[model samples]
Target: MNSLADPRVADLLARLHDEADAQRRLIRDRVASLADEAPGPEAWPHHMKDFYLPVSREQGRFLYQTVRATGARQVVEFGSSFGVSTIYLAAGLRDNGHGVVTGSEVVGEKAETARTNLAAAGLDGHVEIRTGDARTTLADPGGLVDLLLLDGGPGLYLDILQLLMPRLRVGAVVIADNITDSGAEPHPYARWVRDPDNGFVSNSITLKGGTEYSVWIGLP
Candidate 1:
């Protein structure tokens, strides 16, 4: 049986992805519109505070599998965002029977909500939600990270990665979302990871938005 299909995981996802409701899609669109207006991540205030730009169901499942596949005992996520993505990562850790996920979110209320969501899923014990800018919160997360997920502001992806570089295990996997778009401003993160000399083998994966799957293959 697929690990995500577990009753605990299935029950939580159902609450987030209500396909029958059209309003959610509209809200998401409006949030995306606002996001497009931001000059850069630092100027991008907490416009998405009241809403959740969550990972699509497939991407959530992909996160679960990715963690499980890597046998990661420690995971770090930038942008917990109400914990929809956090739950996926923690679920994988739960199935592994050990491990912890440290999630950093810029908004305090969202971090609280994510904590509530994680508790409701019965995986709260395996996760930690740090409320503040990821750049500061993830500066020292207590241990080496086996997998890193960058789902925050696209502009901050590279910065977050750089901040966590020292703690990432050699084979760590870094997944970045929203890096692929046909716009005047492209995320510079793509170039850094795709370059073989930079110690990563990376490529874009087409999902609801777009996800960059990269593996850290450099020396410690």
Candidate 2:
């Protein structure tokens, strides 16, 4: 189940990354056009329809390694845009011998596309694509979650995390994407997780975009 080496997984990931790369210019233009607008999630749907928002190739590999290293049996992903990141997470779980990655996507079309991509990579068995706002779709993950990934709307990151906070296993890792350059959306989430009183040890990792990497120390 070492999917990293599996030709199908490799092929699918490569193609998806290329698709993202091709949209880089469009994304840049869109950002420039909205330079005067306060950055937030309200405009996310428009962007999603215009282009693909995905983790960079390196970041994707990092996600796979992160999940595998943690020995996570259950993973909760706050976003599954086209399933690019989902593939990486599911691959990690498959390599772990047994695990599941449950992903939440608010966009119905993106959720459908994501499922198709995961199936194409032969990793569908390890992923569940729940279509709806993560806060509601992930109300309960069945049991303790060993890892959480937040790559959806920044404005909702804190809310999503709060919804899943009680379900986190001690030492569980939370990885949030697009944390920087999105104005103040991530500030609340960063503050909450970075505060020792909140029971999380958190720091930012600089990827293509910033990612807040936090570890849950659990309730004292």
Candidate 3:
């Protein structure tokens, strides 16, 4: 009963991966210029509105599998972009027979589009896309989160994680994307998660963009 293998979910994911691949070149060029011009996340949603800087297909599958394996009922996603990852998370929840994916995206347009895509995949009922700063929109997830995905701005990873710390149940899993390139020094988020004092035990996983897979062990 793999929901990802369902025609609706699989077809949508295929289309999304293709779309992301097509935007690689444009995203590379736009990001280079945006880095010099705007230089921060404030302008990203607007400038990169047309781009899909989304998670890789492999990452999406990992997220889905994590939800299923953990029997997660509440999932939080920081930076859903156009909802590519949201669909994966939602599908997992749907197949779990219950659960929901709370997604935050600063761009209203992208959020709307993401909702549309989820609807197309028949997973909208399992997802709620909030359009605003994740720091605020996800302030209260209403219940303990079983899994968290940090796929938004690299700079805000730690901040968002800390903010949601109180609501993450023990043994909760947190996955942060784009932490570092292969062989590069760990990103700040990685450093923080890998510190035992912070209540997590984490290590990097080789994904398209470096991924930090961590588990909550409670404060030392």
lDDT of each: 0.84, 0.86, 0.91
What residue pairs clash in candidate 2, if any at all?
none
- Tens-digit lDDT track for model 3 on 63-82? 99999999999999999888
Q: Tens digits of per-residue lDDT for model 1 on 94-146?
A: 88888999999888888998999899888898999998888999999888899
If ranked by TM-score, best first, what sequence of candidates would result? 3, 2, 1
Q: List the residue pairs that clash in candidate 1.
A: none
Tally clashes: model 1.
Answer: 0
Of the two candidates 2 and 3, the one with more favorable TM-score, higher being better, is 3
- Candidate 3 structure, TM-score to reference: 0.96
Candidate 2, backbone clash total:
0
lDDT minimum window of 10 residues, candidate 2: 42-51
Clashes counted in candidate 3 amount to 0
